[model samples]
Target chain A: MTQKTLRKGNEALAEGAIRAGARFFAGYPITPQNEVPEYMAAHMADNGGAFVQAESEVAAINMVYGAAATGTRSMTSSSSPGISLKQEGITYLASADLPCLIVNVMRGGPGLGSISGAQGDYFQATRGGGNGDYHIIVLAPNSVEELGNFPKLGFDLAEKYRMPCMILADGILGQMMESMAFNFDPVDPNKIGKFDWAVDIHKNGRKKSKVFSYKGDNLIADVTERAKRYGLIEKTEARYEARNCEGADVILVAYGLSSRACLEAVSKAEEKGLKVGLFRPITLWPFPSKALKEVSQKAKGILVVEQSLGQLVQDVKLAVGDSVPVGLNAYPAGGQPDGEQILTAAKSLLTGKKEGLFDLQTHAEGFTYECKRDLSLGVQGDRKEVK
Target chain B: MSTILAKKPSTLTDLPMHYCPGCGHGIVHRLLAETFEELNIADRVIGVAPVGCAVFADDYFTCDTVQGAHGRGPAIATGVKRSKPGAIVFSYQGDGDLASIGMAEIVHAAVRSENITVIFINNAIYGMTGGQMAPTTLVGQVATTAPKGRDPKMQGWPINMCEMLSQITGSKYLARVAVDTPQNVLKAKACIKKAFENQVNNVGFSMVEVISQCPTNWHASVEQALEFVRTKMIPQYPLGVFKDEGAK
Candidate 1:
């Protein structure tokens, strides 16, 4: 357990979950996150688990619903498009108060956008993508080590709160290989205590358990009671990593993969004698608002950097409202920003320059796309001349 | 004659069901509970209820139950069975629930040879949603959607689930039964029992499609609905065991 071996982000998270006592996994194939299910199919049986190659993403998540209802530690993994397909089951699990883990190795999208890594699903993950007033625990891990570590933490949080938990990594984080090891020893389901509410086998005069989401008459009471749990989670579970925000004039706020870029940018800012700090939220749902609010007090400018077009900035703006001048540097829809690009944005925030800002208005003025396709392929010629 | 004739199965709960008068669902529910009790697997039985009129089917069973989204019973049942292989899981579904919106799930569940039982009630109309045309509606059946009495050229044919599922290699057992007469009801019970028995014996993917009558949806009296099943519905959906791959 102490040894660290090189592993892909997707594969490491899969093994991490197996160690965390995820005894069931059901998922349909999708880009970037295929390794998670593939790894599960190979190793889950060896560790006393079930792996289902479901017909579709819809079927896969419902399988997770079924397994979780029976008090088994269940999970499913998918990319952006597949995750969208799982919203129905996710909302059902949330409504029924079933605990399970969902991993979204994100790709570009509005439709089947691209297979490249993007943080376009920030709103989807943090803002309850399903049709309900519910919040799932969202853990945004930045590195391979965090990816390997978050599944155990995610599973524990999901069970403790009796809600769905998500590990929101992107295509880059999933496919890129790095050295990381699981932090916890492998868990045994036999040693675990059974949940009283689980709809498993009935035995010896015990009242049979019923797991259903249709509260009909008590729908109001059920949802309202669950809202109290969400409120408690919001207050206590907000997590983030702060770096050098003591006396900075500019601070960069980001999460997941984008945070890694901001971390390097912070050091570059200090070397250039530019006062800059970084606040990376690990729990995107809870948003680390209070901590960011405290960190923003000493700063004059807050630069929100993200892979999506100004999505994370909205949360940052809400967290640090009216106190600081907020700016956005969005590298949206498969756009991966490097440390230099973030540092340039940081430098512009310190000065009165608009060069580094990539907001909708600024970026919109830079390009005028023409709707034209190359029509050269339609020309007919002799077979020899065609070459 | 004073001796106990037919008490309800112990697996059935005391909770009252919200079914329509003369509905076939009541009969099917009784047969399932009896199957669980007779097989001595009631303690390990888990029922997945669908989202039609029988959405509250879980409440009627003393066994552990789960109610999921409409047409997702098979996927959920597959999950429950795979997680606890020793547990006997069944998905109770309606015609519209199994054949229409949930076609992909039911078909794939069979294709995977999953060890589960499906109690399919084909009443030819969507009863809970107020008599809409279902995927199993007869060619000339009058429904809210098929007001012109279901033009075959436009609405297509009623899907024969047993006949269709019988061709699939993974489908181990398939039967179409009815609850029209006393004799047919007993026959239907035998088929329902066989479907559950298949799961208990680890025989993969068994389903018993009951050709039921919906007096409310059919706009007929209970007697007329029963007569219609014998005269009209059964001729199209016919009764008898279609396939049985026992113990395999």
Candidate 2:
């Protein structure tokens, strides 16, 4: 492992993709994720690769579909609204079981959300944004180092399952700098397994292959098989990092940047004579629920701290069950709560003096910058305001 | 006496196509198949099927095929061609998939001058979606969306992709051909062959837009549909190569 001087999560992801043999990148320049395509534009030529700043997110993902069908390692990166445009193509990518990487440096949204950091796309990322009964392997990184390794793992899993894999990160992760070591196993194009169903011209007496999503008549049956695959993934791919849970009274569950804040909050609470622990999910989709279920038994309560309005909190309640009380420090839209607020919440929870049960709260004043882009509601259905 | 329909062209299979009766798509498919065969690059050709009438084109083409999102055939084809430099890539698209939803894809693909082929079938109206108005719908054409007849003020002027694409320097072989008659079918085949040859030689973006008859959408007899392509559609969408390899 060669230690590189400090690199941002976006840069680390780019370097990791290159080391893992990503040769094709298609994306429109969106905030936070601009570095990914920028890096590819400069370096792709030298590596005999391709980089295209597509006209729209829709075009970019279709380009990914094309490249992946040819059995090449390809990727695309964007922020929230842009990722929304890509859901259609991503869904098709999932249906085709094409292996590619999609990096989403999430920002605020139900629509054209801000460009600033927010974990609002948590449900979209982990649940497979596209309309399908399928799921992408969603990996969330709490640190820059994990960002570097997670992409390699994403590609490996994508190839392993013959599906698209997403590195679900946030704007903060994309921008923050940290010292990280770059480690990757070289992928030989020859060693990579070719799906005979992929669309590649056969040259050496090989059978012809076709790649398509028209699994007609039996669409439901096909979707059911995809769900079963997700079941297996849920059973074995749960990943999380536990700290100070030996005899904890409260387990603070968080992911991405919020998880980092929760970690600090745990330490701060320990200093205040409160027994709290941190449960950070690295794989947000195959959500380390089993581990959380086991940990929930020993704890008095579980506080779900996330940057979204009670999204992952529901998952926590489902896993931990009604045996323990669950509290939510929910932040809606672009409001990213900080360590100070989280520490206060942790302290209150330990002392049985916590404020409100599942309070639907917005981010406390003045911790984040609003994105300049229009944060219009982009949901397909009618928007009802959450009070 | 045994009569064969030209051995099903080397690039296409003998399996009966799923196209409606008298649909010009089958003719265009045959022409493309023959073109690939003539170039002796059938095995090295990869085709992208679009979401409209020709969505099941993969089943027709003996070559490797991939289905793209509606109108995304060109972008997908670009990916295949660029990835496998030695291979020939083409997208078979209908009016809805090519002129409307996928407009950005084909236009951008041409602007980028990707070394690929795009076979655009224009029949004036959207045939697969219950005769809806397409971007290529004529000035007075009537479709489900344009019940009052396509008004230039309400519905924009029909998009002539050949003329539009010809302006892009990236396009090397751009042509608007018709497949309404046997004579036109032969001409269309030649045009498609040249486009494929351009890709084999790494000559930039090439396209063959075939003015086809949509009997079902036009609500005309099979013979009348052919007449419409020859009389009305051709006068508006004239047959000729708009851009040649020399320009690129």
Give all candidate RMSDs, comma-separated: 6.5, 5.0
* TM per candidate: 0.95, 0.93
Indicate the worst ten consecutive residues by lDDT in candidate 1 chain B: B239-248
lDDT of 2 at B199: 84
**Once superposed on the true structure, which residue ranges of model 2 sit more than 4 Å away at CA?**
A350-387, B1-5, B246-248
Q: In model 2, what lDDT does residue B146 have? A: 97
Q: Which ten residues in a row have the lowest lDDT in candidate 2 chain B?
A: B5-14
For all candidates in order, the CA lDDT equals 0.88, 0.82
Off by over 4 Å in 1: A359-387
Model 2 per-residue lDDT tens digits across residues A1-387: 776669988988887887777878888998978898898888876788788888789999999999999888888999989999999999999998899999999888878767788888888887888886778998989889888877778888888778899998978999999999867565555566766667776778677788898888978888888888888888988889998876888888999888998888788876777788888888888888889988778887788788776788877877877787777765657666666676566555566553422332223332332222212311112123344
Candidate 2 residue A380 C-alpha distance from true site, Å: 29
Interface RMSD values for the candidates, listed in order? 0.7, 1.0
- Every candidate's DockQ is 0.83, 0.75
- On residues A179-278, what C-alpha lDDT tens digit does candidate 1 reach at each position? 8877788888777689999987777877889889888999999999999998999899999998888898888898888888888888788788888888
* Candidate 2 lDDT tens digits, B1-248: 99885667767777899878899899888888888777888878888998988888899888888997998888788777767777788888887788889989888998898888888999998877789999999889899999988999998899899999888888888899987778888888888888888888888888999898888889999999888887789888989999897344
In order, what are the TM-scores of chain A for the candidates? 0.92, 0.89
